[model samples]
Target chain A: MSTRLPTFGNVGLAETLQNRRLLAGIVVFVVLALYPAMTLNAYHTRLLTWIMCFAIAAMGFNIVLGYTGLLSFGHAAFFGTGMYTVVLVMGRVGITDLVAVMVIAMVVSGLVGAIIGVLTVKTHEIYFALLTLALAQLLYILAVRDIGGLTRGTDGIGVTRPDFFGIPISELPAQIYLLGFYYHVVLVALAATIVLLWFVLRSPFGLTLKMIRENETRAEMTGVPVLRYRVYSMILSAMVVGLGGALYAVLIGHITPEYLDWTMSGEIVFMALLGGIGTFFGPVVGAGGFILLQELALSYTEYWHFTMGLVLFIVVLTLRENGIWGGAKTLVERLNDRRGEQ
Target chain B: MSSEPILKTENVRKDFGSIVAVDGVSVEFYDDEIVGIIGPNGAGKTTFTNLISGALPLTDGTIIFDGEDISGLQKYKRVRRGLVRSFQIPQIYDEMTVFENMQASVLSRKQENNRLFTPTHRDSASVSETERLLELFNLEAHADDHTEHLPHGVRKVLDVAMSFALEPEIMILDEPTSGVGSREKNAVMETITEAAVEQQIGLIFIEHDMELIRDYSDRIVALHEGRVLADDDVAAVMNSEEVNQFILEGGV
Candidate 1:
């Protein structure tokens, strides 16, 4: 038998950063927050803002995949759902309030999610994956053809940033920065969401979720309401992705059917997986890193997708052989132990 | 002997399509008694455990726990009310240590307060209780070890230790010795027996080994083909003509 190992008790935060899952997230958010302070060029600042946009959306996807273990391939639909909800609110009621838009997006996305999730939560594994994808596509088709006037069809709608408390938002950089401030606010919300997720997973309900994920029959035998938790996790999933969509619309200056596309949904999953789902901040880092990688590669050539795909394939293969974040953590611990021994 | 029965299953029947897994079974589980549910495969042992634990919807029966109908309560809700179960395959959280896994259980016990805004880590007593269970389980030395890395025997025992963390009134241990090495089974059973004696919690255990069941259980309830064949003292149930014939026919 192997020698008994030292127990670290419950590990979440130290594991989050030292594992560099949240490390990448911290770097992404900090850089985005400091962009105006760091870079003088307006173009670079906007690019960074776009990076922050995707980062926020990816963070929402992280909440579902990272915390709940539900792989949603149609989060972009939620993103688009949020974005369009905000635009309609802004356009219809002449309401251009960002905070109000964000809240409305959450409620709208949650309701939209409930409508779809009720139909899909009972199915597990690949069926869950396929059902979400189809639903996202169904919404996308509806947004494009059926609700063209409200949604502006496949042509998309011109997303507007109304007066923030009667302050003309578009006329000034600081005002734009205040507009960009929504990302930071969303970041704070995301961070709070992460902490709340930490609490939830540690709670009995969260344990039931993990229990169901690990061993459904065993968990059921233990009296876990599997379908209920499944619905809750998915609804929570929709809320996060929807909030990201609303925040993203402001960042991009427009809302489109592309935001609701499968590619958009697939991107969120990719970011979550790439960042190291072993910890909460893994996707945050992955989203930022992937967006930065996209920026760097796009500047060089049109085949960036192919290049990124290869990179993803390689990392996944390597991660599989070594275990997710397991290798990196062991290496760090070995170093720490050697230092301690010294 | 007490006024309150710890667990009662009232005609709880479950069917998957046309097949009845547990059929109209009524049982009143009392305090301080070790119940051994001895059933052949497909005898609905697991199904019955699930029904009582709120894992499955009952076809027509109510489960009353300490006068509360927990018939269709959520799994976590039942766990909060002190109905904890350990799996046959030992579901220990591999990433956490023995101490952390137990701590999670301690926290999980009060899941309601734990879920609101901030964690109720104000109860310093839980920390020490964790330490006590560590000593009780003899897992003090490797309290920091990620449970996944523990040996099969230690992991299985750690799972039992986790179930005890919530201080449940009743526990269902499903095949606590299955897949455990023959050499390790004796020591594991000793720890299980000791833990049970120390806790004085009602236990419903499923075991295939007649020798082990005979040695530990206060009473044995035998099942064959989803029906109770006998419920009596260990020796009497073991020595029943039906049991003897079943064993002779290689059904044991």
Candidate 2:
């Protein structure tokens, strides 16, 4: 097909890479799939659990930043809100139910998103990022001051392993037993997010988001609800971020106002951007790379954010981002371009 | 005819603080008809269009579309009911291709509840119809052309084509042929007219070129100082002494 714009390597190459959807899936699979290899190392296994938490959070951030072209600085609000919700649901409500806690966190986050959207959905460009960040700070303040009793304010909350679906999580050792459980749980959540988001990007609504990102006014003239869709996507995305927070609280046995901090939100934005934005698998790459870097760097220095910030700035200024996984596709495209030129 | 007004604006008034931009300007649009609103800059032509398209909140008045009062509804909701508007210049996704642009609009016509999860391919049967629009607009060759690379004329045409893909009951084109050279003006008008006539869609266009208003629009609404100085057949509106004076000097 001699279409006006050249695509990736015609049908022959596209057919061969038909398995490319596994690009993100296989990475998660390999990491989690091999957790049993370190059955004896408790510390290493525990570290991997934290990796999964940030990965889920990064996945959520990628939805709006990478796909919708909205850079949200208040994502940690939803993330931490979910964590707080989980703690309150578990401790105060006498509900040790993981499913119930997750559901509640998602609902709370969704409501928070709706409220934030009402204030800021219509604002885009640099204004959008600033507003989201402000909203995130609001969450942090509320956690520290407004709900001190329930949230434990600055001290945060401590809890034990969750009783997930009556799965007896406490009986499972932090290192040996629950590693498999966490590996599975995280992989499942990540995979489900990828599939769900992929569906969204391919759907009409996703197309509209991309359109709104590219040209808000044109999208409006087309009869697409520019503000509503933006708000809707933001809310849905924030809800997912909240789910990440809930999952994090369960995985770490803790919830804190720190989770609501803009710094935490900024880190996810870096993950979304470092891997690349507007590409399906870009933020996943950033999430994976960031987690790995943090894991490796912690052994040497406590100030890993400085190192990451340097890397991020370099990438932003110099790198012609095709995104992380998108980089591979770019290579193939460049090669195809050379061939076409010849 | 069946008692459903294609579009109706009753006592639509909008104010910017102390400045009244649109002062109770009432109008109606019908199926298969093209109406043009012409006025100088800041004549409230754009503001009036924005009000009807749900882009701006009116200070007062109700807008009825197909017998439904859509005065307070959102812009996208108005579009969902087949009331759409286009901007003066073509606004497009620079990263995507021309065909993708048309498809984007075509798919919106079938979006359910505006959720982003459902597959749009369920309605891919309409792809051929969209393709037919591309070909009719002489855009088939440039279907894959990135919007950034499109000539200004083609971009404007693509913008109009994308608007048509929505197949709205009434399309408000804000300066459809604004920037393009005279060479491509006829081509743009040809496509716009074809869609408006075939789909029985009502078209309201704003043009600075009185000649085009004289030629294409079934009727012309002339605004002077945010009030309709003339709303009549193109001949009468153009020949009115007040209109000639307003154009030659300034608002009445």
Candidate 3:
């Protein structure tokens, strides 16, 4: 038997490919970072911040649904849990540190995610989706009813901006400065999230999740503890989404029970599907596109939701289930193939 | 050769609401032997293997592997203890490349599947093991191709190759070359048996091809109607009249 391991022939090519992808990612982030300065439109920059928040949440949704093949329709539970955690902490505990608040929100939401995952990971398909939806709806009702007088009923409550590095954001000289500073905060968060997910998806744990997604039985026979991994994915995904919710709470400066509603869960799913479920960065694209389309439709007509529905229908029909990002990728590939042929 | 059997089942039974698919079958398998299981259609050959691999819960009986009772263990737990199985229909990750398919097994064997942050490609141990298995199975040329697009024979070889990556003390294969053409059956069998002997891993395979069985198996266990009819050396069992009448004559 040969004692030496064989070397991979394509190692150089693979490294070059990875370097190119890293370069592309850096370029994208650079453009995003420069957008506020170039446009000088505080309103538009703030809108982009909103998009980044949803992008983070939708990416979390994709980890479970697209990567692990578990369709969860109650992601709002974690999102809202994070939002509410911020509200409760600032209101009751009086801790207004942005970083501390976000961490607390994530830890609390992750615990909720763990509980839900433990309850629902054993179920499959629509049962899993419905169970999650049902559980989230229960939380929504509790918030609406002001359970234990904590949520303040359905009329909702306002949130004060937390301190950034001990500097009060609300005491800023102008609204643009405030929005710009917050935009950069969210920008940093989104960039960090993208890098984190990139590393995760390339990891062995991530590959095992993909294997489970492809064939659960085969994965089990190959010695994977399938259920345990599913739960871990759920907890990680929820924490990511929960972080987005923490950011959203500060950005919007308000809280409502509707954030926990099943409709919000559906919207999260729509973002993932629209961006192209299973493809990294697709959910981010989906969130930006969905938000922009909704804003455009709302400005044009009172029946904005109907317009949004029609667009979703058209996109689903034309894109062949790849969503916008995946469809665009396929189109580019086909175009390159044609050029090669010519 | 080791004085004690590596795997032993005590009157293992499986029932699907009184159907009794695998009825009170017990067998001992050693780490240095290749055992061929032969039976007619619906003779419970697959079910018996499934019981051993913990794919299905046994209605009754105990399975002791390496002298530890594993009857209540989960399928993946059994695999983690060096008991692994491949399916009849070539169960593989269709979307993954052939190299990745093999890498999954190696990752599991190294207990690295739970690693959350280490890049899989950088895991030199798993990557090299995967490459070695691809070469051993003569699947190196198609390492980059997705399993979905590969030919059936290649997929079969990949499935068995993946099982080999687990470094199991005992490997069970259900019809390892079922879908391959006749011309390539011997080649596939030869590659499998050679790898088995080289690795010093015991192999239990179910096959309908009598010639391949006679050539590859050190011993034969003939099952009929969910019961063992013959358990002896390949030549002795192959020449038995009961084995011939029940399994071979029945056109398995």
Error of 2 at B136 (Å): 3.0
- Cα displacement (Å) at residue A339, model 3: 4.2
Q: Write the per-residue lDDT of candidate 3 for residues A173-217, one digit (tens) a residue.
A: 556554678888899999999988888988898899989998999
DockQ, candidate no. 2 = 0.43
Screening candidate 3 with a backbone cut-off below 3 angstroms (N, C-alpha, C), the clashing residue pairs are none
Tens digits of per-residue lDDT, candidate 2, B113-191, equal 2656655444445456667888878898997788999888888888878877887888889889988898778778877
Ranking by lDDT: 3, 2, 1
| Number of the top DockQ candidate | 3
Stretches of candidate 1 exceeding 4 Å from the true structure: A1-32, A173-212, A216-224, A320-342, B3-5, B8-27, B39-44, B54-80, B113-125, B248-251
Backbone-clash count (model 1): 6
DockQ of each: 0.21, 0.43, 0.54
TM-score for chain B in model 2: 0.91
DockQ of 3: 0.54
Assess candidate 3 and give its TM-score to the true structure.
0.95
Better of 1 and 3 by TM-score: 3
lDDT of 1 by residue, A235-261 (tens): 776887787778778767777788888
Top TM-score model: 3
